[model samples]
Target: MPLSIYNTLNRRLEPLRPRDPKRVTFYTCGPTVYDDAHIGNFRSFLAADVLRRFIESPLCELEGSGPGPRSVVHVMNITDVGHMTDDDQADGGGEDKMAVAGRRLLEQKKSGKLPPGVELDPNSPYDIARFYTMRFLDDAKKLGLKVAIEHDKDASLMPRATANVPGMIALIGKLIERGHAYVVGPAGARVVYFHVPSFEGYGALSGNTLDALREGAGGRVGTENQSGKKHPADFLLWKEDSTHIMKWDSPWGAGYPGWHIECSVMSAARLCGSGSVLSPAQLVQMQVPDAQPIIDIHSGGEDNIFPHHECEIAQSCCAFNASHSGPYAGMWFHPRFLFVEGAKMSKSKGNFFTARQLYLPAPEGKGIAPAAIRLELIRTHYRSNANFTEQGLKDSARMVERWRRFMDTAGKGSTSSDAAARGACREAIAAAMHDDLNIAGVLGELNGWLGRVDAPGPEDAELLREIDAVLGVLELEQAKSAQTDIGVFIGCEADPAVLAKLNERVEAKKAKDFARSDAIRNDLAAMGYQIKDVAGGKVEVRRG
Candidate 1:
């Protein structure tokens, strides 16, 4: 069956057919880099990674052969600047996100979190941007999200927002010249804003009517205030103010570009190759093609559907209409938020934690493995709110261990993979992934298939390995470290509690009560012990 994905634009699952049949260009809205990225942020990243993997897999035909752009070009934008303290503000009244990071670094240094003699340049936005960007990339690596910067044309490219300010200025100028945007405020404090009424498709993405939006806007004015704008809903395109630490010289004044404008400029310049830096007049006179979205897929957290991404669509569509012409993204994909411990992960609730924090050991709390963390992220559907539970983490760890052992045993020799098992597993996995990334369904089917394979044929082993390629977990080296060293044979004395559980499981197995046997094994696994069955009716319970 053809791959189908839920397009947020149309509010339905549409067949994922690229306009350019040879390659797919996808853009995912990345981190704001104001602080350490939490697990909630990584959920969106991991979901995009899964989508990329599936698109490149054999089940999909998006990939094309050539030295040209790979079958997929995934561009993830790092918002290192202009992301405000509040989104409703038209005059960039909120604190600059990079400066926020800078202040945070200064605080860390004062708190002695940084080693002695490493002084941070307080004036440099580069310090904060580079620092957190590296951390975010490191987190992505730990989660095994592929990066496109390492000489891979089809790999994902993470473009920094600050790096494309010139392009943003040019685009904002175009918005002004085309009447899609207007200047607000007076003199040096003038802020350029996108006129909401100019675009007929303004609220199509968020489904908010202009009248309702205007009504809501009365209570949502920014620090500069929207009194000068044509409408209250007109968002800032350029902030011509001196207060921003991360400021640049622009035609409007010496201020930074607004938060929403960066995405439009960067995507157009980087992905679409709109290389020239032209003023609004220059762009309007240039015979640019009819309006069209430069990307194939645009993704982000569900929270960005309004004002942020919605503004992106309006500005980009208007900008394209002026210069190029059309859609911002063929399909929009927004992954639902990831909740922590059954509550919204909030600092006030004391539940928010980063991906790196999960690598630490406890009463500070023992952390979950990165692979297990990734498994937990993908355990639920991308469109669903996933609760990060301790039980779920434990279950994921056990599943990881199970897959490791299965692959190691199945891949003992490179005789061919079991063709039948490989095809069955592949078909099931493809269908799950295609059905709007129904990863929960995929895991259930995979777990059942793996559990039934007692002595995996080469094909079964090969199939499991192939499955791991998309799932992006199952590291045998790490699993080996968790396996029991001396218990490869008959019943060995370990912890008495574990031994007793093993006895009970053995009884359950003999009595043909497989469900009870599996439950006991899962219980042992939750307690940090893996029950591995050895030869001659013996089992080995090892510390995981």
Candidate 2:
């Protein structure tokens, strides 16, 4: 079956066929290195990782004769600069995540929770960027995501002082030459603005009406200088103001490229090769073929579809002109927001949990395993609002445990079992994922299959492993760790009452009354211990 993905550009599910079958170029908007990213942010990333793994995984039959497709290149960028501070704020609506973390650290110090002499380097954005970027990478790794930087191409080419600036400037020059971008004056300062209205199919991605587009444009005026714009909707390509961090000489002036511009430039350079940057004026020459490669999939949070993604499409399409076809990306994917309780996760609300906080040992409060947390976050569909809770984590841990037990019983010696099982599991997983990445449906199916596997044969074992590859939560060794000596001790110390309830559940299951067993499980869960019914009728429970 052809892979079907819900393309935001077309507003429907479409078959995924890469322009070049040999290669697939995908770009996801990565975390800006201003502060520690929240778990909510990682959900979008994890979803992308799953897609990447699914696409890249070699297909095999029961015989295991040949390998399937592998990704020629996969590029995910790290935004170390130009992200606004307003998204972190409720009203200001900018991304001031670093500021929020700084405040929390100060509060911890005042309460004597943080040790004395702890300092955040104030003088250097690069230092700050590197610090948080590493933290983000650590968090992503814990979630089982293989996020590789295109170090040899993009990162190696970047200037140390201003990593992405040089490439960004070169891209802006291409856009200006193509006449897709224009310079505008705002209070004696010049800012480069991309001509958004020129693209006839501007609203195709977001499905916004012209009136809605105008309303959104109205808000962009005060936030930045939009005075020289021909229309209110034009977005800045380069900012003239801003000192001390990173700046490159551009056609506009000595300035930094806009946040959205860098991705277009970098993606083209990496995928299509570093040809002379195409500009609006140069686009009129029919002789020069549109040599820049187009992207197959562009993904991010739904919030970006409007100004961020919309502007990217407009500028890229207009600049490439006849060389390019329609939209920059054939398909667009956006995951829904992850919320803590009912509200959006934020530091100011005291509800946000960083990836580090979720995985690393906490001083006092209970913490879930990194794998369990990842399962919980992805349990719901990518398009659905995932409400995070301790119970949810426990539930995920239980499900993971069940799968692990089945795999262990099936054994690992039969290579054919791995291949056959993986094939069937991939079919099931792909069906769920293709349905708008229906992760909830996928997980539900997994639980049902686990319940049915009494003594899993080689087929069942391989299937479980394949599914686990996509789910990223069910390794037999990790499941063994779920009941290790240290794990039990940690559970006992963290929540003894909950542990007692788990023992009661085990007793109920021993009595052979499933109703009582399930009730006991629920009761123990209320207190925060996730119970898994392993093979041989043994029960393993862990503190969530």
Candidate 3:
């Protein structure tokens, strides 16, 4: 049987079918790096990672996502700028998230909780974004996210939003040319709004019609924001914000792109390929209509279904489709919300926990094992609301420890071939996993296998290892150090080689060679290092 998952758009189980059966294009809405990604964010990520791993696993070789060394082209974005402070803001009504992060980081530094040196500029939003981006990646490593493990190996797999503004600008321009978007207000302060009525079925994904949308109106916009919009339902493509720390040069003005726009562009750019959003004039020529959505699969948290994902459908179909052939992706996979201790998990409530806080040693709390954290985040069905609690973590820890001991006894060299038995067992788990990612069923099946008295002989142990690859719950003790990419972590001095690159960049800046300077800066940023210009021809470089 083919792999099937719950498609949120159609509210049904759909077979995993891609444009190219041999190669699948997958995209996930990754975290906005304003602060540490709390466990709720990771819950969604780990669930998606399960799907991704299954797509590339041997279970898929016969009838699923197709099997090869590079069959699934998975891309999870790194959102470092222009995220909304409120989810209702399709037009970026509140302050930019990066701007908020800069201030919040400084406050944390004052509170003596956050990690940043005294010399680090509290005003530099880039510094804060880089600092947290590295931390999030580190947390991901400890949890065994394969994409995070291979982040440095393939630059194309993880595209950063700040690094893709040019593509965003190009996509917005395409919208204007197609009559789906228009600019308003004065030249410098102009805001580009997607003309909602121009696109039919604007609210089909989220179940809000244009009339209802007008009543709800996405967000409570200020007089300034409300003044320029063509219709109440029309959302922002770009906004003019001179004070935003993360503004960029665009056709409309020097400002930030809206929260909704980033996912549409970033997803299309990577999954549909980079040429999908290159240059304004060439966009029409690059991607022709009738090909429908160039992406095969798109996944995110259930909260993203509103103005964010709905707006993505409008803008993406308008910009990338000549006719509305399909949604931006063939299938939409959304995991339900994660609750904490019977309440909605929120930082304001003091229940919010990062993966690090749960797994790494800290004074305020005892740490759980990294493997347990991974298991706790993903053991529940993706379609169900999974409540996070201390008891749940403890339960997860016990299970992980049991598996570790079982593997020690079972995971060893063997001569016997249990290929038929192993294949049958994997088929059972894969069937459950593919049935809307019924993860609980998979674990139940695993537990059943574990109960056998003579279980995990050499061949059975090999099969368990194969199953664990998809589960991603094994071998966390061997996780890479948090500072794998960075030569030196944040709050530490830069090494000699990084210093040399910094000096080279400074020299390039002195010579007014902006392209070279920008290239050097981006190269360093990709290596998890960020630079801040210091006084008198000097620079500060920190990595984490």
Candidate 4:
């Protein structure tokens, strides 16, 4: 009953082997901070969240029935700089995503679109980055990202790429001294490239050989960045660009680190570190040095498998332990892409959706609650593509409401469910989760169990609490104001005063104080609130 997962490195499903049972170090790529994260991007992050939740859960059955990882040292990086649009190359091609943000913000500023008191200097990419970074964090919180929730309390959990320039420069210098990287061009416009061919296991993760990359396989090995590279696949580590909007002083020149370098440096510094310095060279070392795994797992979208992650492997291997032949980390996980309405999401197609665009209630009375949005994004298996549609979102809302009612009902019960039945249900849910996060399977188990139970008991509530600890979609305390979008009517929390009165009425009914319940109803009517009891535990709160 050991937890198993598909490691993208060797293309094999294997057991999770964390060197330490107390603390499991995990890292996942965060938003680029140039724009709002689209639905597709969140699907990838949701996979990472689920993985962390399962890894830290006691339900994760491990080898010899030993105690599992007690805690997860999760680090998700905020790419406020150095990420490019065309990320397939080692030295990322195309425009800097932050620069694009700066330009857009400048235009908005000139048009007076930016709000007052929000003094945004479009010329300053740093200002633009912070703006979008905060917005992204807001969205991540609404979607229940644990790292995002604890980010304010622990800044180390989410490191910004711009803040780690020194670390990037240090790692690049190590690569150069180790002969894995070389500097080229003039002092005012110098460039550093990782000698991709120097690392023998360059294509072990992505299966893209140097031979194929040289021939422009998949058009990933771009001809634009061939000026100073030892090989076509030799990705850029540093580029001198004092003229750029966001430039940094580095060993190579006054420029910025490449997109691929940030993940390597941040992952090493944050996950396995010494406060301000990495004197012992943390996770830059081989996978397991003397039976110690500095970093456990790294994850991202499937699109990152290429030059982004591949180059990370080559550069980190060369910079940390030049002779070691292993992937950057011991394990790698990637989630599949997300589509909208059976097609790739595109603005022109009117199917694209940012997290906020769907989570916030719209003027047309169409919107998915935050928890429902989180549910929809993570309900499917990570390996499968989730096709988002309005119907699907509405279904998620109903599902959330259903779970809320179930939990509420369970809380009122004084007895326990059959012990064997409860154990079987928990086992089934855990088994589904251990199978590489079979979200669909786990949810199916939940629905089937809920349907069969006539009277939910105290044990059911405990079971739900355990399940929800991993799947954070159930906001048990939130009885959302019963929006008209979902087809069913249900009792929900309204204004504070109304909710308190309703609670009083429900309590009075439980105590058989019919007179008090009737008086509360009369009081609600006097307050211009129409209260009607519907069958099947649904109460309508129609405002007069």
Candidate 5:
């Protein structure tokens, strides 16, 4: 079966297609690097990771050609600038989020809360952005979300918003030249706005009419009214202000680009190739040509469906291909929210938690595994809001442990790979994945198959390997060793020192030396070893 997905643009299931049959350009809206990313934010990224895996899998073969690393390019932008708090559509309405975080650090320094030599400048947005960007990427690494990290030559491309400011300025100029944008307000305080009425399909993506969006603007309508906006809903393209330290010199004045422009510009520059040093006439014609789609798929959370994504479509279309009457992205995918304890996560409600918080033991007793976290998130359908609970974590851990044991047992028998066999279980898994990523169904099928296994046959072994290509939660290779630990128990290999202790413990037990054996157990526990007594006067030593 061919791969199909629920495209949010047209609100229907569509067959996957790329402008170039050999390659696919995938773009995902990344996090604003101002704070630690919460679990809710990671949910959307998890969906993107799953989608990329499925797309690159052999099961996604189209006619005869198969998608692979060279065929698919996953681009996730890092919003290190222009993102602001109090912005409904994530456009710059209030203060820059990085600047706000920097101010907090400044306050902390004044209160003497900083570590000795740690100095922070409140005016430097880069300092705050760097701090949280590292945190966010570290969290992504811990959670095993697939993305390019540091200097790794990975499949995904991560471009920063600040790095593409020149491209943003050029795109804004093109918008103004095309009569889709206008400059308003006074000289130094001038702000550029996208004329929403200029684009005929302004609200096509969100299905909100221009007049309806303007009517619902409420207090925000008059907020920019003093800026001389032609319409209440005209979103900001650039804001000219000298007080801001993050300002850049633009045609309009020395100011910063708006929040919506960042995504549009970055994606265009990275994926579609915006000319860096082209003349004004040359730049105007340097839009994404209609020969191929600029982006094959654009993925984000459901919250970005309106104004944020809608604005992207308008800005991209007006700046590049104003005559084209289609959405900027060929397909759109918006994963639903991830609720905690059946409620929307909020710090005020004491339910909001980061991936780091979720990685540790919640109540200080049972620790949550990162693999378990990955499993629980993937078990639910992406379109549905998955409710995260402690019980869910426990269940995932148990299931993962069971699968590991099965693979370990299977590993002892079959050491050969079946080069041409496609097992029934593997086929079912692929079919489920092909059908809009029914990962819940995939898990159900795999779990049911695993439960009936006393020992995996050759087919079962091959199936396990094949399934893991998409579901990367399994640790089969580690489980292959005889003394391999499956879950909380760590495995230990027999060494001279370990054998000496094991023999001593056995001798102590035979001599009815309970005190000596207990002392030995405590000593082993201190050294990260757990001793388990077994049948035939033998003992199992596992690393903790």
Candidate 6:
């Protein structure tokens, strides 16, 4: 069966056929580095990760389908600048809470009310952005996301460096050259706005009329207004004058590139070439050689459709000249928002859970593991809003424990009847995942299959491994020592002689010597070490 995805542009579930069968270039707008990311932000990223995993999964093809001649190139850009706080704020009334808090803290320090040890750095925005970016990466790692950490790390370390400024300006120059954008002076400020009037079929992606677009744009009556724009729907390409913390030298003077332009410049520079766009044939050629370059799918929250993605489409298409596409992407996927206790998780309500805050302990001192929280987020349909609660997180943790127990049971022994049951389980799992990444459905199928297992067969074992590859929650082997201190238990406390004996026993288990393994376990138990058999035939030794 052909793969199908819901494209935001067409507003329908369409067949996913890349312009280049060999290589598919995909791009996702990454998190802005100004603040700590919340779980809701990571949910969008997880949806993209799952989509990428599906595209790249070996099981995606039918049996007899020899290695398909295709590759997926994924690119997610980190926005370090030009992201205004009011983008998501309705009526532009929302303030940058981080900045507000920083100012308040500064005032307290100035009044000599702060304790002697307390200190507030002058470069609070820079410090805050760096702190949150690092925390975001750590959280992403815990959730098993394979993001480009090296690039992100470099950006975080050198916060002042701007690598793509010249290329970005050139892109804007091309847009201006092609009459897709124009510079307008409004309210004594010269701002570059995309000429929405120039693009006749503007709202085709959103299926909104011009009047609707205007109304939506005009509705945003914030510190920044649309009066300067040629059309109310027009978005800024460059903010010419701003006293914001992060600014760059651009053709529009010492200002910052607009938020929407970052994706365009970054995507074009990384996927297509600088000053050149790839044709469909060239894209195919690039992919055939296993060049995981750009992405075939772009995903985010549903709220990013207008202005954000619309501007991205306009800028990218005009820059690349639609040379290598059936569509800009094979698909545009988006997940729904995550609410806290039936309400939107917002800072105003004090219900917001930043990645850092979530990693911290709850009121009772018990906290959810980052991985467990991630699983709970993914347990719901990406297209549906996930209601987050303490009970919900506990439920997800319990579910993970159940899966771990099943894997452990399967590894120990299996009966013929159990083997057959496991085979059925594998089939059910594949079917569930095939249905538009229906994770909730898959979990339900897992519960039913695991309940019937008296013993599992080879098929069940293989299926469990495959399922782990997709879900990433039941990482049985890795989770064994992930939460505890292995070094402290094994080599830290014990004498050299005792540690040597323990190492020999571990080696025996590695060599599959059951007698030696059992003897070692007995010896460890006699000692202060507690040896427990975990999933995948591995033993976790902890100091008793």
Off by over 4 Å in 4: 82-94, 107-117, 215-225, 274-294, 363-366, 476-544
* Residue range 264-344, candidate 6, lDDT tens digits: 666655566422443323322332112121335777788887757766766766555444122444477888898987899
Residue 126 in model 3: shift from native, Å?
Answer: 0.6
Write one digit per residue (lDDT tens) for candidate 1, span 1-544: 6678899988999877676656677888888876778999989988988888777766653323322233666778888873443244434545555666677788877788864666567568877777777777777877777652331343226777777777788888777878888886788888888888888887778876586665675545443544677776777778776776778899889987877887876665556643233343443343335544557899899989987888898888887764423667888999999999999999899888888777433322244567888899987899989999888888998889788788777778556544676578778877887788888888878887777667765777767666776778864123212223323211123556766777788789999999999999899889876667767656655444
lDDT of 5: 0.72
* Number of clashing pairs per prediction, in order: 17, 21, 0, 1, 1, 10
TM-score of each: 0.80, 0.75, 0.81, 0.84, 0.81, 0.73
Q: What lDDT does candidate 3 reach at residue 165?
A: 79
lDDT of each: 0.72, 0.63, 0.74, 0.77, 0.72, 0.62
Which candidate, 2 or 5, has the higher lDDT? 5
Residue 108 in model 1: shift from native, Å? 1.9
Model 2 regions more than 4 Å off: 58-67, 82-120, 148-162, 186-188, 209-212, 215-225, 242-245, 274-293, 321-325, 412-430, 475-544
Residue 50 of model 5, lDDT score: 79
Off by over 4 Å in 1: 61-70, 82-93, 115-119, 148-156, 215-224, 274-292, 322-325, 360-367, 413-418, 475-544
Q: Which residue pairs in candidate 6 collide?
A: 25-294, 25-295, 25-296, 26-294, 26-295, 26-296, 73-293, 73-294, 418-455, 419-457
Q: Model 1, poorest ten-residue lDDT window? A: 476-485
Residue 191 lDDT (model 3): 83
lDDT of 5 by residue, 404-520 (tens): 777778878654334333356667878888889999888877887777666565667767767776766773122212342211232334545666666677678889999998888
TM-score between candidate 2 and the true structure: 0.75
Cα displacement (angstroms), candidate 2, residue 153, comes to 12
Winner by lDDT: 4
User: How do the residues 109-167 of candidate 3 rate in per-residue lDDT, one tens digit apiece?
Assistant: 88887654534566887787788888889988889888788787876677788887787
TM-score of 5: 0.81
